[model samples]
Target: MTQRICGQVVRVEGPAFRVRGTDGTEWHGVVRGRLKKGKRTATAPVCIGDEVEVTPLSEGQAVIERVLPRRTCLVRRTPLGGRRTHGKAPPVQVLAANVDVVVIVVPAPAVRSTVIDRFLQVASSGGVQPVLCVNKMDLVPEPAARQHVAEVVTPYIRSGIPVVLTSAATRQGVDELAALLRGNLVAFIGPSGAGKTSLLNALCPGLDLRTREVDARGRGRHTTTTSAIYDIGGALVVDTPGLREVAFALDEKDAGDPLLLFEDIAGLAARSRFQDCSHVHEPGCAVKAAVACGELDEARYREYLRLRRALERSPSD
Candidate 1:
């Protein structure tokens, strides 16, 4: 007789899910009814990294009867701008679910805070931990580049968010990065060409994932089209492709939901003044204060404010 068990979804395709149970086997399971009824969302519900309950029907078949409440999730608006989203952007796209840490990889100093900050906002809403990992440290070892990274990423670091400078080429911070992700499920997210795939290859040699060069025109050719789960020994990382969507969330209704992610920002933002404060211009904004007092990166602060304003003007927000 087959056994029933709870599993964490490592991958999702259509309504089928690739889940890993505590028994250490990957199973193909379909969602149960009650779980779907609860969400009632426009976008298809199941996402990579979801924790669910599965009952075996046969050797390779199982039914997903329920989705155990997710401790964290990363969500975004759909690509097409629409009014259907109510006050903010329309529909939430869950890149991955139930992740413990969100590892944001970006280029040193040149890393755009607007993108990172927006990511922070999404993660904060999901109740996940965020870490800034600066890749290509080899290119920025000298004065200008190195100083730029320091100035830009300081804010996140000051917020108790771990910031690690790394070089996938020289293997500079690979060990440290691996150690940090050891025994935890970390979700790697960033724009194209940030060296996330390269870093993954470094951590688990011979994995050989495809990558591209950044164009002279300054735009990165998007790679890693879909989200994938990579397991390196004891550490498992969920690698998400570049975010093609630009929708904002409504009213921060999920603000208090533990299922939502982004604890780092929420923890700090809660101390800020104004219950509805967007963390942009409100007096006594702790987020801004961190930037002004050299506790946060100015570039990050500016970008965070920009996203804040965008969210403010966004539909349903």
Candidate 2:
């Protein structure tokens, strides 16, 4: 009989994976022949939150033989990075598996609705709940900064997305965030310098994930290189390295109605003169009218257009 043990993958480093067994023991494991022989098509055969069968090879060592089924997975086509890949973008990178909620962290002082929209699309495309977490509230304590944060998150909140204002530096809203994530597996994602790690440290209290200051350019340096999962009380949190860009492979069905992704805009679009209104320069377009009347945030409308164009340019378009 094989000495097989069931475990969840906490993180992956190159070809090795850190798996924590149901017995609460962790072991470094390598993928066995089955996984390496094209069992899965993802760029990364294994990812954080993956449940797998590990066969112990020796003390404190094991080999992953089979990956159990995942309830949900967050994936994105990674942009070109580091080495040249001959002009082709990398295959779908599985950010995490079995995630219940994807907390999209955005910094207030430098929030970009485009980034938030892209992550929203990715989360919905992967069948996961998306939460907008505005981190670094400490930087926005002043009235002007507070107003900026409010303005940035207003659209998302109106769209029915859960928005949490957090400040890892001052430990503000950390308790609320913890409660929201309790009894759930959540993944924190955002651009490089959005304070994802700092927020995690604040929530867990002793993880001490490395932190770095945003440079003079107002961009955050990469402090997390690999995705790692940690058990904070009853909640499972996965912290990932900052993403510079996000892409979604939209097909005809997906691209046919980009407005559907924007809840608030979609509601207005439902009242448009045409059933198939593109919401761009279309006559009697309720969505456009909302933007003109100042009922919708112009920035969000522009982001909608940009994402719509991106979808229109998809291979299926």
Which model scores highest in TM-score? 2
Judging by lDDT against the true structure, name the best candidate. 2
Off by over 4 Å in 1: 1-3, 13-16, 32-39, 81-89, 215-217, 244-246, 254-307
Question: What are the per-model numbers of colliding residue pairs?
Answer: 21, 0
Which residue pairs in candidate 2 collide? none
Task: Give the poorly placed runs of model 2, Cα more than 4 Å off.
Answer: 39-41, 81-90, 249-257, 267-275, 281-303, 313-317
Model 1, range 175-243, lDDT digits (tens) per residue? 888888989888987767778889999999999988888789655677776666788857889987866
Which residue window of length 10 is worst by lDDT in model 2?
81-90
lDDT of 2: 0.83
